[model samples]
Target: MHSSPRIRTSVAATVLALAVVAPTAAMAMPTAPKAPVEAKKSTQNYKGLPSGVSKKKTLVIGLDGAAAAQINEKNTPNLAALVKNGMLAKSNLYANPMAPTVSGAGWSTIATGVWPDKHKVPDNSFANPNYAQYPDYLTRLEIARAQSSTLVVGTWSPIPQKVFGEKTDLRLAGGNDAGTTAKTVDYLKNGNPDSTFVHLDEIDGAGHSSGSSSAAYAKAHATADAQIGQILAAVDERKAKKSEDWMVVITADHGHTPGGGHGGSSTGERATFVIAQGKGIEAGSVRHDVKISDIAPTVLKHQGVRIEDEWQLDGQAAGTIKADDFDSLRPHLKTGVDETKPGTTTTGWTTTAPSGWSIDNSAMPAGGVTEWQGWSFATDEFWTNVDLNQGRETSVHNRNVFAVADSDEWDDKAHAAGQFDSTLISPSYKVRGGKTATLSFASNYRIDGPQSGEVFVSFDGGEPRLLKSYDKNFNGVETISIDVPKKAKKAKVSFRYTGTNSAFWTVDQVSLKK
Candidate 1:
């Protein structure tokens, strides 16, 4: 598990200084801004079978220890070609307590469609895995569709022996990357498999022998690319003869450090990516929200499998993923003014609300970090890179841009006065009189020092009523039901946070339903 950094004197001094400032009267509620015209939703299709395809098939390729940032056209031409024809999505992995950025935890998450907290594969030892409760997707598919054929070949023995299940039609352990690629190519060319998974390990071996920055690592990429090219050729030949639709997805388990090691929370070690090309998937598109766990569900989706809600899978199909209003702020994000760790060029953390939302900083202090003076919308890359190894990596459930109230990062710079306090107001929603409405949102709250997060609701301009108050660590989607009083027509929700050099609170994918 990662440990918190020691609190600096500047923050402690600021806390003492703020203790003397007298409290002022409450300010009036600010007027909500006009909602912008809703942009036309993209016509890009991510579901259903393509026009000519009668049969659906899936192929998943795993490249061990390959970081998304290191892949380029020069070294990995075939993988780059897949990106050119498909979608390239970058995502990070959890570290330490959740699971170290190791192959055991990473591959388990991809195979089971859940996080380490559920799968219980905390390290390479593979102790007390919850596979019986949450089996590999292939095994689940076998149970759902008895007639479908499945195959799995892995260069790493543990993957085939322990990760995949006994129910798979065929599971083989190839001694090395070349052997694994050859087996996969032979099967695609001669066999009639409905779904296949292949794991290549030479790239990871190279990283372990020579650092990721070494020439040997680059050579490994070239070799792996060639192997992937051969596999793609086999797939093309099979497609031409069988007249089938194939959705191919390529991804990595975890990334490597510059010096060739992993199992840490550094940006390099935690980095992972997804590249997919096939029916219903947009061509030449890029995404920042897809995660490693998405591969299992995406494969099941392409193969016409119904995902049950009771499974409690942590991933959604890549094609079916949609962006929320907060994600639309990506282009408008600004470079950091006080956060020097992520550098001055990173465009992230904007205080400007998306459309109908507003941030109330009327009770906030004079100076903190400009990026986090109030509730700000930010991307994962920008926020997590500020300081590594802080539980921020566990914010895996949140996608794209989300709301953040970070007193920890804000205290990194010199502030004039006061503790961190901000409120995020939501757009007014239509509510039925005398009926119950549910407010649902994904929240991740981490507390280091003193901090409090409270939720309030007001109806028809009535006084705000408390719904929930958080003073401890909480993570997951929260659903709170509110009884609408008689004759109520409209309701507005608010989130207020107060902290003194504590951790952070992130909110995303908020909605209200009756």
Candidate 2:
């Protein structure tokens, strides 16, 4: 687990005390539920503007510290309506090293379309932010389309003062949540803004004052939900008068611990969500691949701004995201076995590989943790819950179900065999002879003790050649160019991991393109 710097304040101390006294209910994991039915794709031609609508605009509402699991039709009718009409995506955040699950890092990642490692705002102090390189989405819109108007209204001063750039048309700092909502509502109803962002901080304050499981937290959500309803009403009134298309996005920066406070690796603290309704989005869809970083790109894409490759953004547009082969295994993922930290009832971790892919554990460990004995497919929720604060939470880039080789968890149980040795083999792909092919995959490799992660490529069923070796920490997508043999017609890729009471390696979205 990543370490958080001490917050020097009386409130911080009080929150810490509350955390110890009232542990979150999530600490007691529930029995594994049945696999969820796959979401159906919309068949409607959800492209281009609707009839009579000429311009495309967007509104992003940031509800600080609101947990997705807590929202429902009873408590948050307005937000629940949006979820029924659009899409709700549950996601997690990083802790410590990458950045604490605090407002500074969370909001920055949402605005900049990148993680804290790139934005450099780890804590609330906002020391040395790299907005010059990765500016907020609204700032990027101004640079890309100067004629477009942008507005940012927030209760949190740092958001409008530091996170967003000065190029935005209007930046307002509301003294409180009511003030922020008033300013935003006025703009949406009266002003002709192309893109707008509103941040509400009352919910987070409520969480800090009272535990997330407390009635005060629920009341805070109700208050914010009413405020959001006002904002949505303004949008509707504007849409009724003008022939315009509006996209609304509601999201949270981070979640509070059950007993309040954050900046830790607990499941509740790491929780974040995205609820979006707009053109091209499937109604009532639930997805797990969306990240907080995706908010910026999603807004940019909705407003018809061309995302430049030079920007090096880490997020893809939410509506445009297509599920990878590994993501398709969600419905097939099995409940936990031989692991009891979060209980053996969690519905994650599957040793079954997708069609055309295979896992080889012949070299073999005999009696390790059943779930992680080999390359296993898993969701972030299950894998991170196994052991908190071990840096698994930092794998924020990989979304949905990804392949993991966790010897650390596997070694928890007594084993009758040698060290963990497993290989994940990819299906063969056709390649042009003498041409360079790119092998792209998202990889997060952490080393502890003695461990090795190697990537190999074989051409035309010939001897495999070493493509890359991982001996240190790596945490992003890797694109390697491989020169095909003069007479080679096909290629297959493989990821082999070996460890002895060491850390782990996770790989996902593997593809080979010429």
Candidate 3:
């Protein structure tokens, strides 16, 4: 139904990670409503598919790590079959840019239909050692899916498992034998969940390990395809006997590069397809643009959840695309691009200005200097000396920007523009006389509301140059640039300092290209 993937140098490049946090007392116990498994036994061979509410059931098969490169009609006939009978395309699901593209963030967003910060399920580590937890919005649905209403089955990480444990009866646990398929079967025959989410992990794991095209990767695809066939068998069994408007959506959580990594900069890293089919949906539907964030929102709409206001997402209800609603979250691109690898690592070249600038992790003792081009702030706390803040003020600058992001941790301040700025601070960039370059950096400003940030440039000590500006009133536009004439080569671009410095933008890919 969607795809996800990212940056940086040896400095660990500020990964949007899931940090460990103890679960609250409420999360320690499971949230599913206790009921005998026998009560669901009498249902037909349909998961999330009730007897009469054909339109009530929605199934999302999350093909984690599946990308555009691995998809083929011949390789995945089962998915192709669904598309042939229904409509499917790319979709956006998350509103925040740093919603960690990994399994934890993407799946949690899918299950909850809310931003990672809102759901509070960052990754596996939060709940488990390997995975994280940030809380989840899918707890009740997991119950609904197990009852006569919905069923969720897939290869999921411990991240989601911790937030909504034992909520569904047909859960097949990810990383197990026939994990994705077994749960689909359980729902089809025993639970009949009205809304089901099926997932596959091997493909993504293989892609992360060996790229998406390696032999191991190919085998994973073929195997997952075979599994899709099995799932289709179960879904088709009901479609054949009844005039039901069953729908099947097949898509990947995120894509991978050719060398076993994703994120950062590359179209290949963002490239994944969506294929859908069923009643009330169009067949042979081909869409050109869809972000991975749109999948869960679409599914939730199909399930009759008022997702519009509950979730602050960038995705749209793609279910009606066949009916011609094309205005949805277009796409949010990676700020940096690495010309070498399939995934984005670095974009341009950058260095600290007025050399010998103080490089300290005072703000985040654990986190190093988070310098960027324009913005550097924190949310609830500043990393002034490696200490957390509930929103503190600290400032130091030598014409650099900085930021810190907990990708899967989609909490409050994480969505604003700056967790660091208290007042207007300006950054400065200068170009020699014959240089034309670009300045790009990864920042978690969290300024989705009314706020503004500006970029200032200087040339030969002349007047200042303002490359671009951001405010609570910032409009939607990717790859913004303010071209400096050749005479402006002596000009530089960066953010000026004013005040409010709780975080730093870990600067990278700062380049002055020809």
Candidate 4:
């Protein structure tokens, strides 16, 4: 029997399926409960409504692990239509450097309008989540205004039933896209739900079985687009029959790697998009700055729910919705370096290698290549799992940068580990206002035998001061921040990789900001 395929619950909440991979061991999987359940009766229902001529309702479609680059006019017609008439943005997901990027964490962030730190869901296990402190938006809606009808459905039972853990007016579980669409259509036509959420699982599944850029994944994307069209059509039909004014929003929890695997801090894994189509949204407008956590507050605001400061959410309403608080939010990296290509050189970086460090573009995972010994930057295709070369295709760590020692090299020999005793120094840059400079960068490293990786900074060419260090094993793309010396007029950073190495050190998007 095949093992159960790894399933990522919707990073966002919805009743639709976002299962990226089909269950491998279908027999081992429990049968999905066949019907919908009624929500618990509320003791008190808040009757507050927005004062307007037309009633307002919300519909959110959560497409799990969908990438913006893959969606377009021809492939995802429905999504395209929404974009043509709405606002779209390449939104960023707040990442936890220490945790694996999975469904539980992503979904919780989406539901609560906060990052993983607030929701406290770091992995798929969903242990010790701080739901009481940061409950899902639906739960907030149910509690604040119990009279409003809410619907939540998803094929992934864990997400709908456990992760979000909200009791809506109507909740459905376990169904294919066709079934989900039909049920959603019936509910929209017959019942008037103030808020609705739908999830889709097929595209993510295809991304797992076949690579995200593969034909199978493309087909799955098309299928999801068609299904979304059906759901929108049903909403329109409902509008035709009634005086319902609906605001439709769509978003994804995460993006998949080119090789069809995720859970890293690579660009592809963290990149996601948001689409808001409503009366206020600007048609065909594109935004670069947005976040997945912004969805909950936006939806609540549109529904006339007053946002309370006591909730302590991390997101503000984005897109067309006016939000004055978002101005305080700014990019962590204002200035930096890129060294992920062949023959790349920094004007100020000085290298100290007994064997000399040079820029090259190849690596030998199975064995060491003599030609790659002096290579400066790590090649994008140098993953330990070489079979999944495509994984290096998209959002690769700045196209893969490297810091290695003279003896360090990737080898095919199972036990042939070497030490990397080399250092690369950065150019001197002014730290404005004496102490305003702070440095941050993404680094990925692997070590096998002994010793470790270390980073140091020399202020005005003073004694090297240690900043941070790492031991053996894998440290995925991590953002490390350090404070520069206030007294130093110039700062030179250094990366030291000196230890028995099974894996090399790679850094990218190095930034020094005031």
The lDDT leader among the candidates is: 2
Candidates arranged by lDDT, highest first: 2, 1, 4, 3
For candidate 1, write residues 1-514 as lDDT tens digits. 1110122112111211010122122111112221233522123211210112226888899988886666789888899889989999998888865788888898999998999988888887776788877788877776666556777888776677678776566677666677778878887777667788888877787777676788888888889899999998998887454578889999999888788778888877888999999977788999978998888899998877878777888888887878977999999998877777777888878999999899998888887778888899998878888887777778877898999999988887778677898999998999999999999888989889998999999998899999999967887779899999999999999999988999999999888886
lDDT of 4 at 330: 24
Off by over 4 Å in 3: 1-55, 91-100, 127-147, 156-160, 163-166, 174-179, 239-241, 263-265, 308-314, 320-514
| Tens-digit per-residue lDDT, 1-514, candidate 3 | 1232211111112221122334555355343343456545335444333432334666777777786556668776666666667665553222223343455555665555444554554443444321123222233443333343544444444433443344333333444428547656655655445666666766766777788668878778878889878876776676433644555677775577788865432344544566766556667766643344456666656665555332345455665422111111112212221112212332222212223122222232222222222222221111222222211111111011233222111121223343333122223355544444665432223232333355565565566666665443221212434556567545444443222332222222233443
lDDT by residue for model 2 over 146-212, one digit each (tens)?
5666778887766776777766666777667888888778877776678889988878877886868
Q: What are the lDDT scores of the predictions, listed in order?
A: 0.79, 0.82, 0.45, 0.58
List where candidate 4 sits over 4 angstroms from the true fold: 1-54, 94-98, 239-242, 319-338, 341-514
TM-score of each: 0.87, 0.89, 0.52, 0.57
Worst 10 residues of 1 by lDDT: 11-20
Model 1: colliding residue pairs: none
Query: On a 0 to 1 TM-score scale, where does candidate 2 land against the true structure?
Result: 0.89
Against the true structure, candidate 1 reaches a TM-score of 0.87
Error of 1 at 93 (Å): 1.5
lDDT score of residue 73 within candidate 3: 80
